[model samples]
Target: MSLAVNASTFDQCLTSIRALPDGTDGIVDNHGNPVNISSNATAISYGLCKEVCGRDSGAFEWSVFSQQFSAWLLPWLALISQLPFGAKHRSDNVMSMLLTVGSPVLGAYSLALTVLNSQWIARRFSGFKYPNVGLAVRALSSLQQVPLEVSAEYGVLASMVVLPENNEWWTELVEGLDYIHTWSISAASSIAWVVIAYLFTVIDSFANVSENIQANGQGVGSVWLWLLPIVIGWLQVSPKCDFDRVAQALEKANRKAYLADYPNPVPLSHKTGRPAFVLQHYRRGSVHRDEESSAPIFNYARFFPWVHAVEQVAEAFERASENALSHVPVGRDVPWAPSDVGVHGDNRKGTLDDVQARPRRGSPIGRWGSDVWTRVIVASALALSLQWGTTGAAFMIVWFTPTKGLGCRSGAYLLYGLISTLVWLIMLLSSIFAHYSHLPHPNSQHLHLRGVVDETAARLSVALRRIGKFVATLNAVWIVVICLFQFSSFFDRCYCDSSVIGLGKRAFYTLLLTEEDIPVLRGAWIGGTLFYYLFDFVRTI
Candidate 1:
């Protein structure tokens, strides 16, 4: 197959494209061929081009040159271009909000959470399944399962490129301060994204991305391990095809019908809704973000990782309750019933699912270091819990919940009360469910000895210990709620700062918060939450 290029067309259009700023991303690594317009109805089309640029860097060089050149014309625009369209000046808007996570020192942490949250939701709701498969294949499938969108990544990076810190205002913004923390945070965030964007663009992360090299389709997932090699190989070559007569053949086609024979239709400024100046972004045309595989669809699902994290925390609390209830001694007249669930599966530890509960033999307790002191500790904890609920007892014996000042947020300790009451009810109900399902009481050999109250207490204990798992399983709603609030930029109502190091006395609910004398509460929350999840994820793996 022959590809065509017209030297005069590129020479004529170079200045117009070079003067473009906003459209730089679409053309960064764009590739397309020269095709003469019929009746001026045809338009210039560009795509993710590789071979036609002579070398990989050639495309990158052209993209950067045009970008730098546009920067030089910061005080200029509305240029006339070869493809016949005037460039409309574009500026920052909500598109810039994708990178709005900057400003707090926790920029990278928030970014990582955003990415992980996006991945977790994609995994949870995905209809696509990886069947019972080989380990290597399953792992690879898992890798592919978590797709990162290049388009989204591109949008974020493009914003960072034009962010305030990268321009002249950066100096004035940092003028008097010996060290500008927020500016530094913004700079760091932009730098990190610059690397991410380069990889996303240069490596071609978009899935099933018009593998025909110069065609159109939609999908976004990638095997960067493989693309890395391809990029490296392409970087070493300068491609030149012997297609001298291809442009001549196209030039001779006067009838538009002849152009329809080609599978790849040329995209003109009119064909695409964008202005010609926007089209001038990449190699005399523009490239578009593909949407396929459901992952790239932007929505609230992107913040789901935090939901998963909170659910896990809730589950942990439930497990603590379960363990405490299990140790409580039965009454004097209540005959001790064995919990050995009539001999279930082999007592293998790691082989069992973390959430799955099996009956345990009630013998040899002292051998495992459960002596008088342990019993005393348990009894004391139960007393305190009965009086003050788990949160207070938890505070007395242990250092209490790691989420500091959580209790202070509510009126008269009402928040902890709400949390405890909810958890207690959840545990009691879940324990009851497990009793019905697992029949925690081993088939009572004393057939007539089954007492209703005794059996009820045993089942309730089991449920209390295991209620956390149920909370986690159905935690989708809470997760979505927290995510909406965490990154929410539109939270107009403000409140007092109950955060660990909240500003003077007030705090906003959303993470994109800025205040003097206090760290961004939401930023720190997101960052800390993300860090906990990272370790948790690692432990899980």
Candidate 2:
């Protein structure tokens, strides 16, 4: 469609058209066909003016201002969001710290993927017909795919080790591998999220560019879309170990040991008329055994491999200290207890009542009051909310936006995005529920509401895990299918005049765009910025 108005008038009409709300239609094409303003804003706007005015208009100018604006803005937002700033406590552990430090590398790798697949870059480099240049581009793009595929493999390993319930062998392997496993899992998780974020960004950017430039071709496709299920599966199967809970358990264990070392018969306190030193063992020997058995073990060796050897040394020192203490004077000089001291039944009963009424040491209520844990929870909630909001927004854009037809590449992306988002939503809800269920609760109280919440959380956890396993298996099959398509040339000849024809052709076309069609630098910029967002989600959640 050609505009027929003068330059000044055309600008005014374009401005007015943009200002009008979506679906407002007075615009028509040269054939007198009504043009929907919302379908393709820029294109329809031009078409509207062309038919309204006669053929004496100055040269028409195409505007890509929206694309330029988003190109500048979105990357910065992704970068800022990816930084390790909000949830500082997450990095206190070794596994998290490794992930944090390796984020930049992952971000760079993602950037490379984005650049290689970018339509904008492809358009610019389409002029280069040299065989050598094409080969170099293909090699670079091929290199970019390797890390992602490797990371996916790592994710599978991590899921197998961490996901199964009551599996002693896997647990032992994880313990034996220790930091090796930690680094591998962290790298896998970071890569999966990074690649996902960048792929999402690339699609969003493509849409923006498409709308801005009025480019009419099949929307981009990617094998990366198949990676979504695997990532979601990884998230579903990964264990949710609350750092705060572990820290509290360790602190409680240390406090118990300290208390255990105190003398059994302690002097009575003057103010409360209670024992100055209350031996937990004296009050409840059986209860102590039960609590110890039930208490969560915070094994340092799982995080820091060196901690195991240190623990052995510490145990030796502890034994020596015990031996020395045992040799020390058994009894200290003190006021002798008279027969009358314990003779009064009322006094003895009052002392027992006071001991019973005393608060249990290291209670859940006290642990929950920690500022660090509170900050961690708030940060996690905010991060998860942001991820859900963004994922929902992307899904809406892809699903609701008007496309050519269901046979087009846009349809494929829409289907992939929809299914992936649904799976992601399930994983997200499971994570949130897991977090809630793991919170410390008062063992003394059996509140109906708490019981209901726990039950609901447990059921959701079980259902999601089952779904995750099924999806993981499906994804494995999907990956094989995608690989067969990538390696085979059978679909190279298949093309639809109206839409993308075969799955192999569509997948091959997307890979080709990454490997040969797009320039290296531009792809890197786009992918890196978008991919960096994975780190933000990984660290915060």
Candidate 3:
């Protein structure tokens, strides 16, 4: 006779199985097939067997296979459904596009900046006076002297260019100065992008792991362990990117040089008992004399009153001699003259119009509201809030979820934090090397010791910069690889029963339900990333 068991008899069956002796005869099926129960069979194995043999076996298997699959798929479907009806899809699409497109664009932009800065630095110090000095030493010297040189040379060259008659060298010098200014701004922008991208990656990685740990009931350390790098890295790198600070520094340097160039006349006497003359005039005359000393000496100005007269006479005589000795075609030998007044009329008129229109541009408050520092402050606040909110949410989820594993997630989370800390440390070391390298060589009685110290610092700075560049390049490549892996894993999770992209993606996405659960975090992440790209782009321009 066939025996039928209902839900109430299921417990009886379990009891009978548990009571059966280890060496007893096994039960037989309807077809008279005998099945032996092993002594090693456990309650878990028996339960699994019942599950497999149950009428709902298909549902049970599907549920087991679709744990992570459904977790992501449902949200994806929801997102897709909202595409035509809501702004949610638009934002999601934009984020996805940025992940796919903006990353490479930013990477290429950074690479270009790196190349340009490298070329500029090399060219800037290529003319070091001492052949014995290494390139690193020259670079350090150039960096240290950049403010002074830019301030002094820019004003002088600019004045020459503004004059009615100027040489090609003056124009080129002015252009070179402009190039340096542009490069400084670009360098600052590049560093900012690097720091922002780094923080973005760290936050995203933490959120990914957090979701998994929370869902799986795993205990991990505080999120501050992950956030500490953000604070430290920002403190180290943000000053480099502050446009206001850079601008103020440049302005102060220019003001100092300007003052030095046109200092107030102070009465003084020469120890040799020469007449008290305007020192500025004396210094200018001496410079002219030194420059022309190789040529036939002109009658030296004996007194202060005779200086300008003597200079004019000497310049005229030299010009006449040069003309007599040189030969040139009549057309090409035309005397140099300033351009006609009419030639600059359009530019002058435009300048006047621009001046007149300035007042109408905006109110003082509006201008202040649009200032660079204002934007920076606002962006920073938004980014910090986003980071904190996302981290807090993750913690809250973990706190409420029933987790079985207590410390399993800590190792991986700490590993990520450790890597970030190491990178920040490298960056800090590089900054320190750069600072020391640019310091003025100390005045000491022991010249040899001073030289050795300076050279050592320069070499270390050079090596550190190279290392930093390599690390930045490697980090960019790593980010690209991670992005690709994530994309592939996303598709694999949706289509395949198992992840085909390897265990890295499998482990990463195991607990992550969706891109993000909170709308604010999802939007903030996208906005913050795009802000970095936009900020860099604007700075570059």
Candidate 4:
């Protein structure tokens, strides 16, 4: 138990260490070489870990931001859900389903919108930025407001009103589809979380919910929590009818613009001898090319200089080849010849010389046309709403029904929603900050982007500053508001007498819930949401 002193003894030990078995010392193969496997195992393990878990973990983390907003908003949603806004309508199946289903969809849509509008505002102008929250919300409201431009001229009109061909209903249905496309990523994500929570409960159920209940270990709810969202989502099946109609109208508008650009495009060749037609806009050509002069001319002397130089090169090559190939004693069949292989390359440039140019195509209308920004803002709003809605559902499931088997699963879906929302939010916030930081000061600070566009492109210098200021202000405000709401919600849930803990203590205790783990759970919720948003922000670019 004591120390052994003396350098002599230590020296002897060191000597023994150096005198290891010959094979062990060198670790040489038959040829006697050193082997270093230190990095090999490390590399392998790192690769394995990345293959098995890294992707999912990264994905989970990225999903957190969208959830964060949801986390903040869930308490409000729960309170709203519990409110007696519709006593008479509560029992109505459609109303019940909408509140249950549509609410979350809307939340997710809002989250998506927040992100997208922010991004758009960021990308559209050089400076003077804002969060576009007002814009996002307005866009969401716009789906209801933007009149369905359906006409009886389109067959869709027939489908909107009367039963199978009900155009009016179809129009509304299209509006709803637009709504879903805008927001449902988060909604679906929340449902996915519910599935996970349900699975966790299912696993715990194997041990005994009753015993666990006695031990306050009651499992969460069934995985079927996910099923409800999916089922409810199915009601949106008819929404495509609306999308098809809208898309068709937009397409028609594009075609009209295209055709207007080329009323007759007839050939008007003069001494210049330029042809004005191209393959892309080819019609049954009213103007024809002169067949006699169509043949292209080539300069054999300049182009085939390589062919002329080949004889000199061949002499050297032939000597080398004969020396190399002849060295291989040919007792066999035919030997290889130079002419057996001929090289070819596309060196032809003659066609371009006399080629006549056609008129340039009209300016591109982009993937979407004039209403592109408006559509984008609306879409983003929908995404944000859906994300929020899902988070709300998850929070309710976990907070109110912590004993239910699907709470964790709900949490999982909430996590996914959080991620999607976060990405959107970050891009938005970046754009806003960029806009505001670059805003013009003093006399020009209040000037809008319109003025900047109209006055001079140079005015954008100030506009950029405003945009940056807008973004920074927006991000700061959003973060602060979110924190306030979150804290408020937590305080309400924790301190209130009618809180989940107070009223449901018996059930909570039965499920073995611990007050100590509350912080951890909340942290997980917020962290996950944040992680997701940050990741998605990166992805949006």
Candidate 5:
């Protein structure tokens, strides 16, 4: 069971031991030559089990900082920040301009994380850099304050009040949009000068540092893995709207006159006032709804509920199965009765979901609330899925490194991440287009409706609303695809472990590494990933 510390010579020794006396050893490397492994790898594996991970399992902190934070959440937050406050997608505005020009925060934070985690950067930066529990909680509270992605649906209603042919509301928005742009442009230009003049070399140095980690396989920065997520927590403290001011402004602009002017804000008719400004807005070369506010962007938020529901159900079944295993009668023990716990949980979830789904009889989620919730749910799922999916794909990229088809893995993952993102728009547009034929359909409850901009916004709005289910389903599919690929691209687990684990040492010695087992190991990896998603998919449905 004793493992030799001299791992460097392990592979060569294994190759010799595995070779049969008559030279019939059949294992080979990627180049394909006779090799040995049958007796060889087993010795090394026994040593690993005896040394590192004994049969007994133990507690390990979730790698939210190292694997999850660095791998996914960090990059995802950076991407989301590029969008304007309360906006879902980035439009051609000052926000996008700022993202392009003064994105030093992005570069700086990314560099800082890598540097902090760099074991080679010196001893100073590499260790337990995450904030304490109290600080992290306060920092996280800032991100959760406004819930821009959730509140975005209110944007449609807000837009109705905020946008008119000639009103302060409309002027404020346009001004706000431009206001952000002017300052952002100015700041970006200033940053660009410094970047051009001095920081280019620093940028190159950072790239070299990153390459060093990737090339030899990022082993150094194990100690300082928790900082970036805390930083992301800091980033979440987005600018919030003062609801008190909003109400005050509403009071100042007398309700009746405000409704008369911004009639569209009132979901139902005012029992008076002119019809909404559908004809007027479209009549001239005024800003198109798509340009001003891509309300459809919020439509995808519907998947949030579905994703939440899916997770709950999956957890439910997983618990049920685990409980069932624990309760199983061991070899002629007395019979056990089925537990009602899982059933009760399911009933409660279904009851609540159905109540919310109906949106009538004083249900909060009915009607317009339902529309908002649906998109919020879906958008949330997509966001999480994108974060995890890209993270998974990145892992896949790292896995394939130093193998024969390394370049192929990079190409495959590039396509995977890009396609997964674009899929949202593709399915969204397709679903909306399909729903167009349905016409002015009744929303969730078939409640009596208003027809202000029905001729204009109704078609697009209804299509967007109806499209949520399809996109939600598609989101589930994309999640499984990326997770499965991630698991499959786990091609180098043994190789990476070779630095320490005895099985890895054995594999390296006997040529029994992942590249050799691709044919059969692929099916196993796929089955495992799908099995993991199965509970999720069933619960979602």
Candidate 6:
């Protein structure tokens, strides 16, 4: 059989493959000359290629598989590349205030919750099972290895990619991503949404401006002018793909490293853990056989040694797998490499003493020793910084503007409250539906406890904990009220005719909200300021 190869290595494996008998479409080099080959040539060819690649048979197979997937990866990436623009441009208006703020909040919340749900599902349903007469084989082959550290890292990386820092590109991407999820479309949808939204909003604004201009023949600067185009351009150019790519690469590297370290690792089962009963039965049977057959004295000792060795092997495998799953320092913080086991000071006694001494006083909830606590702290701080920046801007727009005392207008405030409430309601409903759809049925069974009743109770306990946490953190009612007040418009309306405010809207919402409207715009300012701290509390919990 003919196979493609690099030109430099064309002749390297040819001699070995040329010795087989002739067949239809037989082996040939680039010149297409008939080359004799054997009936079972594929295996030999594969072995030869493996030798050329300097890899084991299995590794070679994996490499080929990765390459094949890589071949198709570009088209897939191209599809993803179209997301922000497809989703954002296709919308009916450019930078809709309702959408700009609502989209990111909804998207960030949903994405965060989805990832949490995935983590919960993976942790809760983890086990091993077998069907029918294949139970023995299943027992030997199926293992439940929980890579807790890896899972935590993956969750952290995912949250970072979804939740970016305060920036224009971030706002566009988040909002764009939210629209994609809300509609469940490809990135191409995002691009289309942006373009469409820009066109319609610009056209509508221009139509109104034209009517005003015609009414008095007043010289009106281009109404929609650069506003819609700038939003469109920002949406189109957002670096969302790079972030996702980096995140995916990290996850893949970590999982690959983990699985490599713990091949077919299984969670310890009660049956597997206690092999004393099996050994006792075997010893009794062996003694009876020896008595009947008059076996040599060495035979019993030999059998015992083999049995003990087997037990040791099983126990060692269990320990290694468990350690890997627990994220006990492997030997490197890098995912693909073994973690540095002794880096945090060997024996863990010193580490424990240091931790106890420090006590981590910033937030009580974040003092947990898990690495997840670090993520919670970092993400919380980031959220806080963004909230403060946005609140500060709103303060300036409302109270410190040069021409107008940033005061709230009644109609605009009403509009702001209405829009915010409506958007939040939709967000809440969508999240509820997403969570509900992912729930396991009520009649689920345990893998290790077919006859045991306590396993069912344990599962229920875990489920209850998860539900309680969700209810407390995802407080839908408070989030709605907070979101309603978060928008600057709720405090003060921007000068309707000022093109500068239109351009600065994203900046205002993101870092510098300066709206001058409503009676309590200043008091509401504190709410925005405190929102991030509260949000962090929710996240850490």
lDDT by residue (tens digit), candidate 5, 1-541:
3123223323444545454353333334423343354453323332432333333312222331244233322232333333323333344233322321122122122222222222221231122121121221221122111111211122222222222321443333222322111124433443344224223322332333322222221211111112222223323322222222322333332232222122133321343333211111121122122222212122222222222222222222233233344553211233554445422222111121221222111112321222333433443353434233323434343343223223323443444344434444443443333323323446535333334333344456445433432443444344334333332323223333222221232332222333334433333323423332343353234
Candidate 1 — which residues are off by over 4 angstroms? 1-447, 451-475, 486-490, 496-530, 533-541
C-alpha displacement of 205 in model 5, angstroms? 13
Task: For residues 303-420, write the lDDT of model 3, one tens digit per residue.
Answer: 1112222222222223222322242111122343323431221111112122122221112212111222332233333333433332333333332221111122222232332333
- Span of 10 residues, lowest total lDDT, candidate 3: 294-303
Q: Output the worst ten-in-a-row residue range by lDDT, candidate 2.
A: 294-303
Model 4 TM-score, 2 decimals: 0.22
Q: Please report, as a residue range, the 10-residue window in candidate 6 with the lowest summed lDDT.
A: 214-223
lDDT of 2 at 254: 22
Q: lDDT tens digits, residues 44-97, model 2?
A: 322233343323422322332233223332233232222221111332233222
Candidate 5 TM-score to native: 0.31
lDDT of each: 0.23, 0.29, 0.28, 0.28, 0.29, 0.27
TM match of model 6 to true structure: 0.23
| RMSD (Cα, Å) of model 2 | 22.4
State TM-scores per candidate. 0.19, 0.29, 0.28, 0.22, 0.31, 0.23
Write the residue-wise lDDT of candidate 4 on 391-466 in tens digits: 4444443443322222223344344445434444443333333323333344565467545543443233234323
Which model is ahead, 1 or 3, in terms of TM-score? Answer: 3
Ranking of candidates on TM-score, top first? 5, 2, 3, 6, 4, 1
> How far does residue 406 in candidate 2 sit from its true spot (Å)?
8.0
Q: If both were scored by TM-score, which would come out higher, candidate 1 or candidate 2?
A: 2
Give the winner by lDDT: 4 or 5: 5
Query: lDDT tens digits, residues 238-291, model 1?
Result: 111111221222122211110100222222212322210010011211011100
